[model samples]
Target: MPQHRALLIGASNYDMRGIHSLPFIPGDLARLGSALRRRGFKDVQVLSQLEGGKQLGANFIKGCVAGFLRRAGRGDTLVIVLSGHGVHAAGRDYLVPEDIHEDTHPFESGCVPIDWGRDLDETPADHVVFLIDACREGIEVASMSVAGVTQWGRQKTDAALRRKVAYVYGCSPAQLSLYVRDHEAVTDGVQCGTVPGESFSIFSRAISDVVTSHQGALALDVFREAVQERVSLLHQAYRKRGNPQLLRTITDIPHNAFTFLPAAAGRHEAATPPVTEYPATPSRSTSPWWSTPASPPSGLRPQPALTRTAEEDRLIPPAPSHSAAPGRGQAAGPVGLPPRLRGSSPGPRHLISRRRVLLGLAGTVLTGVGFTAWKVIDASTPDRQLWKFNTREFVQSSPAVAGGVVYVGSGDGKLYAVDAATGEEHWSFATGEWDASSPSDSAVKSSPAVADGVVYVGSQNKKLYAVDAATGKKRWSFATGGEVYSSPAVAGGVVYVGSRDEKLYAVDAATGDERWSFATGDRVDSSPTVTKGVVYVGSSNDKLYAVDAATGDERWSFATDFHVESSPTVADGVVYIGSYDAHLYAVKT
Candidate 1:
């Protein structure tokens, strides 16, 4: 088998003066490196701020090109993962390196413009996967923000370097990447208070999760879906907090090749399929009686005709006005009522007053009777119908549906219990951070899993918490090496969770005691799904492992084409997963 190579860049520290705090760029890069390594990439290079670099601009491009040239050949693939600040200018997007100074423009002091194929020259890689987690600056955020930048860089003058590259962005050009507090802290300290930055870059985290979970099934469409879902979740979380203004941007390169496909070769097709059109509806007239008009009532008097010859009428004739008629102007007609004395029988005024009084009495009686009947019916009606909760946010986590209630976690850092039938919120538990504790400049992106009346969830706070399911009250929490982006899975009286700390933790179900932990090369955000005697999970390490559920011993492992952030779903006797390599895999024990 040909050796695979990858270059992962995570820039957490900028040259600009700011608080040197927890940024997820480094963590994301670490996870990417781990995932790629697990996928059998013999050489995976991770460049982070911790590595100490001032010329990251030259270093990143150089590293990527070198890696590409080193391992890239016919039938070989090269993957590049970048998690950092990205901005667009003059309609072009640029990824910020670790040494970039926010105060300076890209052309002046930051990384100069480089096309997507800048490093592909002399390399004959079959596929090039580019994952960029950054914010795109200028565009409409609402519609486009849900999906990261999907437009790839156009082929430029560098024909020698131009090759097949698949790109995935974190957000669209108009949206902002968010950063929030972790889910575990209650005190208002630096570690417990609001972190002032975009927390989880939606595109980065989604790519990490999808690539890790799917394990070799990371196609273009699947990657877009995962990113879009995360963006939607972030948008909803911000909207619920009355901060809809936060947005992010995502863009891709070789945009033509970035499409959802069932297999790797499916991405090679060049043309976009035509959209289907629907027929128009027929028009109709608004008037109810367009064909005819109503006729006048019968028994009305007709006017008399005049008699005169044309020459005689023109020559002579005059009338005596006094002999015509008396009180002719005051006669009753259809247009007016007859003049009546004060006590005249059935006068119009008298009739109107009587009718008004009768109508008032009848209306009052009917209103009272109707209200009483409605109240009785309402009281007798049952309120047991299933309720639909339409959250603008993505419920990425599976909800615990029990006790006539649905318990789930939101990226907004709240654990909500809604009436399953009515969709009404019964109670909520707030974890004052984004679900994914990336940095103060990132967003929370984890989900809660409930079992045994206790909710087990991981947070950006770098901790796994066990809370009372019914009350939304915290029972106990255990700090980990890194942020806990993985959902908790319970089986065999134990809880399993993976954390950014690069370890899979097995905790006691009753008490928050650490039973054992299996350390991976990178972050393990892929949640574990237990089967008959095995636990199947993917890791940023890019390997899907079937481990002994009781001992955490590796039973069988499969390598993918790229990072595996995808959580494994086991059905029948087969395990299905996706990978950032743009391939979905099905493995059988």
Candidate 2:
């Protein structure tokens, strides 16, 4: 019997600096993958960030995806599911890699370009489907700032291979996909959310529900119509927006690949009543559909793992980063800030009185000022920045230097390694690309700590990471239950850091494995000072803790009336830290 193959990628946590993580994705895969397996795809392989701590989508083409494609011959089938962030640049759309740094290479690097192969003839199979539950359209949220959601297109999709290639986008590049609570007004078809009734991304859940409930051989065209209606109805029910169309897939041939392999067992035996409460509508395609026998043969049931017959190839290795900062000899513009996010707070407000504005500009204090606006710079200050490196966003992070290179994190979701002298980028690491963390939560805030050919840092995405100091390659990363604003202190082959999830973690520096953890009452954003056998840090729970480095056991804690975000320092036997309560304490070790 002919068989089917699938490569599923679910990136629940992103490392991109400004983007957020999608914790609901593991549910997406477990639900979808389980259903597909039951539908008879024996070769369903998955790469999920939530389950196994792996990268997905962006960099997979060279690593695992290509291998799977090459091993697939003429009649073999391929289905790919990408669930994560997507960005557009230079007239093209791309899926971000686990480590995408748009600040470093917005066009080509740190991304996966979507297109039919340059040589369609060289492709492994003609039947390929890409069901992407990502924003092809840019995102817009009143309270959030998203960095890389814009789409740029230079050429139309390939019409020659229309029948062989299909793309399903969750939402267009013009808007964001929201995770909403059931607006009872919305259709009751299927609402997806991490909190069950809340935080649902209606798009992904609809596809999963349709896949599970379809009665017979699922035709691509029919699936498209159902999605269009469901999404359309959803928009109508709640004053919402968005259209999920089959858009660029399907042919005049109607059913496309859904009806391609009728004789193949377990492929599309029958369109039994789908596993949903909503009534299933008859398909709109004119192409023939298949159905399983009233009682699929007595012997047919979910099968156990079978010996593989097809050769499984591996993805090609990626070439070294070509976007590294140009050598000093090259001429380049000064580093620029990322574009400001849309709908951000308005820039400096204007003062009403010209005299007050003049005084404000002159840095002279007026009795009441009585002005709503004021610039930070005084008239005495230079009007122009001396070759400023515009990051296009807030540069709250401190800078670190080594080997004439300056390393810094940005609100735009990048850790830029730039030439100290010229301000040209040498390389950058996108957070979500590796195990570093999601860019969501003002993601990369901790400063880089470079040591022993490695760079270590923390992110609001709740992870601590160690990357190659020279190449930006990820060495290892460890996740915490909450946001990690705590900087890591390395000593004795261990990495110590804290998280908002109220725990301090001691992980192996080399393997990125957690050795031990000590829980605090609240969040821990305080960087630790490790010396001797004790680690000193502060927590939002209004306390400072001294923990044993090796055992993760607390030795003692000092309480204050207010929270403590300040790190601790030690000299001799005295330990000192400041508290939000407006007091500084020096405790004896």
Candidate 3:
């Protein structure tokens, strides 16, 4: 008897900087696994980051692929599903691992090459199906350019596969198979979200719909037509100028290869009832779509344990990172304000403007002491004092006032929260320690951004941290190549910040995963201001840049005579920023 086996690998969270995390991959894997089972794929194995701390590195993925292929002998039908970042470089297709970095060489050891020699053709399976769902844009690396997704040309695919094989890509070599949440409304038939609803890529959802809904022998042409129709409808629902990602496949496999009919069944087992749901409909049965069946027969064998040679380990080592050091100790003390902020220290009563008073207060707060609550003099009463909260070091990072709580960062590598009314310390979170002897390396100069109960800030120790606003518990940390003096701006579930590595990065607010990065000529100490889907930030390279918040692509930049350290302020479609050249620039958006 012929057995059906499947190996599905989905990479949702990426640690690398250039590639963004795909929140939909887990869902895609579940939906496809269910669909394959319904079509009689008995042995389904999945490998993903959802397994917890396990990293889907290049060597691990290659080992899994080899192990799965070895078990698929003659007369077996094998399905290999790869859902993640893929690329085409040097005329070869490569599946990018989650740990692959921008500087890693793709063709060498960082990526798994999809070729005929070892990945597919070497397998003894009678029938093989390869499915991929990834972006198809061009990736710019170093000085050379490569395709962001697998681009299997017709001629190349034809020459590569000699056996009964089917190669299907979710999109053309120029489109991205979108996620269900990207649309205004989720389609009725497609499953989405992080729970049982599994977020699937649009292309995988369509295929699952066709396979699960159909009850009888499914013809190859019919399956193709159904999937194409679903994809077309989904593209229209995207509402992004009708950007359609048509299915692209090059196959010579027989129609019966994908059908679930028994050997004794006739040419057409039965016509399934008409499924009314558009864009990947579910079955009419009331049972859950993800319900599983009983175990396979005893003859079914398990795949071999994943193994890697010494050479493989030497060539593809774990991804390197320059993580920040751990915090030293916890201290509790009263935060204080400099005495200069006290308005009562007057030899002569001089008129002080409100702006001047606030400026003086800020100047005093940043003078390497604690924060203070000072009372300004008024005509109704004399000058007074409320309270003071002190940290062990300088309080340079401005405080964020939210929900009657004040959040601020100090040069001592700690973020403190205090009650706005009582000036009492609530909690303190130590970001990390670097060199205590060098204040610049230990300071948290970036002001905090509090959003959705999370406080985001950057430290001089070359990292950004997401901490709980109320409890001061650390959520996650992201490492950059250099010191991060730039404050973070949170918008649309993304955090944008700058680093001394001359790059501005956009990270996922919840997971602290890098979405994208935009490079500049010099260090980027100036903070970023995000508004209207645009991020305006200044760089030490003597330029202020406007970048697309979602893609990290540069929109425009204004050059100044000297470095621009002032954070940009956008109002009435104009960006206002100051530079060291003794000028405040106001550029139209």
Candidate 4:
């Protein structure tokens, strides 16, 4: 394997209140750096405010560019990780450095904005991984005004360098990052003097674990599963203590590979089984009519053969009908006349034969009718109920059905698995936060979407999460520009979603890599509807956009009255969406 180069930065101080409490800054950075070096990263640089300098911003950026120039090559990988407070101003994401002042604007401050497109061109590497751990402004929290605001800043190098880049963030714009007391260390017997407000960030821990445990399994899909599992566990542990929510956002450059695995030996397994057996017998019988024998009365007598002239038999005259013999008087002949009693009536046996034939015909007709009825009933019957379970919170989202299970997110900040047929809960993973953003006061308002064995969902805390559908394990998470009210739509190895931060993000479904993004004028409450290479989403700005799913380019946009928060449902060459203006609009593609 080729050696990779990385520049890691962690900021522990902030000009803003309640944002500068990172006690494990040095430990986290050192641990991460050592881990990366062990994983074949030949050149890894770590920088932090603890190094001591008011010029930290200038020094960090200079170091990053220098590292890139020194080790980055056409085929080499460059990873940049930043952990600090993040703020958004004038529609741009900024990673706040410890030395950054209240007056420092993102453009002026050393902060890296979400639109780091300029940096992508300046760095020469096959793949660039940009990780930011911070709170995004203009999102979940209210914006603050600093006295004596400074003007925007500019990048020193303007040279365009085309390179693949993957950007990952810690929380959605509309959400806040959580920190908890150092419970893990305490449980592990590590002791430090009375430390007030000592805690670990849920997402940070999950990321570290993924990089450490999975080793070469660094794809987005694998990472997401691990992170979701951890986050769920943490959520359950601190539900009563008010833990912070974790959100994730990602962007990936075209043809960029983040994981170390070769394409020939992909992580996903090949398909094998075609169908699964039902837990219980099906509601209807599976046997065909020929498989079972029918029972008939043994007392019935056999009918006599008809006697006719040779010429008449060849002509095949219709059988004659006759009334029953009067009180067992005389038997009727097969030709319909009374049997000759030397000119008298027919015998009782003749009458009995006629009755037997009539009864057999009736029975045949009835059996045919009965079989038809059975077929109809079986076709209409529903499958048997297999399982059922309940959650502590209410479930507002539709469940994702896969592998004989139903995966759902609940308002209680937990992802639950119930038997699809029986509704029995197989397992539940907590997300560590409540969803206060839903219109209803339900436990989980976002439905879970499952693909490739991973469940993806958003919460009221303005975060999107991915969990293992089978074991409820945490995977990787990417923060978004805003609260992830919309469920994710996965296709073509990518996941698409909208955020209240007013942007649509396309992330690699496998590795949480950001592919592309498109901005809207207002909040994007509508979940993206993808089809035939196009993405359709509604915005609070009252417009419907048709964008190329691959490139995130705008194909067309249609304006409507009022905000369009309802997710667009696409089918039959038509896009149907609802608007807060009290109307539903149908658009033909």
Model 2, span 221-243: residue lDDT tens: 55665554445433433335543
Q: Candidates 2 and 3: which is better by lDDT?
A: 3
State the lDDT of candidate 1 residue by residue for 55-115, as single tens digits. 4664566566566565566756666766555544443555656555444532323553435
In order, the Cα lDDT scores of the candidates are 0.50, 0.56, 0.64, 0.53
**What does the lDDT read for residue 214 in candidate 2?**
37
Residue 7 of model 4: what lDDT?
78
Q: Lowest summed-lDDT stretch of 10 residues in model 3?
A: 328-337
lDDT of 3 by residue, 194-269 (tens): 1122234677766665454433444454466657665655454333344557665655343322442222112133
Worst 10 residues of 1 by lDDT: 365-374
- How many angstroms is residue 565 displaced in model 2 relative to the true structure, after the best TM-score fit? 60
Order the candidate numbers by lDDT, best to worst: 3, 2, 4, 1
Quote the lDDT for 311 in model 4. Answer: 31
Point to the candidate with the largest lDDT: 3
Better of 1 and 4 by TM-score: 4
TM-score, predicted candidate 4 vs. hidden true structure = 0.42
**Which run of 10 residues does model 2 get worst, by summed lDDT?**
333-342
Instruction: Give the Cα error of residue 448 in candidate 2, in Å.
Output: 68
> Residue 338 error for model 3, in Å?
74
Q: What residue runs in model 3 are displaced by over 4 Å at the alpha carbon?
A: 106-109, 136-144, 150-155, 158-160, 186-199, 254-589
Q: Which lDDT value does model 2 have at 326?
A: 31
lDDT of 4 at 563: 64
